[model samples]
Target: MPRMNDVGGQDGFGPVIEELDEPPFHADWEAHVMAMNRALIGQGVYNLDEFRDAVERTMSHESSYYENWFRAIQTLLKERGVV
Candidate 1:
């Protein structure tokens, strides 16, 4: 079965908007989340595949992009007993 995050080729979600000149992040917390994800990956806390799996496991349709990443990190850390 497809995961919740797997919406590719589906319908009713509307088209994706391309924001020209979009900032690297919309908020400070998103940057922090990115940094944390990088640190965790660099430290061998989780591999890229594991991180993606965690994200898919915790996927929510209402969440924004970085929000999903943040949630996935939380789930991974907790599952690994690192937090």
Candidate 2:
């Protein structure tokens, strides 16, 4: 079965679009969320593939990338009883 993160060779996804001149971030918290994911990985909490799976499982398409990353790290840490 295709994992939730698997988007290759699939149809029905809408056209990709980019917002011109979008700000680096919509909010400051987003940067923190991203950093947290990296920090946890660097601390040997989890590897990148695991992190990706967690994010895929925890988030829907509606959630922003950073939002998914934040949720994924939380889910992984909680599952490991670290938080």
**TM-score per candidate:** 0.91, 0.83
Scored by Cα lDDT, where does model 1 land?
0.94
Best TM-score among the predictions, by candidate number: 1
Q: Which 10 consecutive residues of model 2 have the lowest summed lDDT?
A: 1-10
TM-score, candidate 2, is 0.83
**lDDT of all predictions, in order shown?**
0.94, 0.86
Tell me the TM-score of model 1. Answer: 0.91
Q: Give the per-residue lDDT of model 1 (tens digit) for 37-80.
A: 99999999999999999999898989999999999999999999
Clashing pairs for predicted structure model 1, backbone only: none
RMSD of each: 1.1, 1.6
**Per-residue accuracy of model 2 over 2-81 as CA lDDT, tens digit each:** 66678899898899999999988899999888787888889999989999889878887788888888888889999999
Misplaced by over 4 Å in model 1 are none
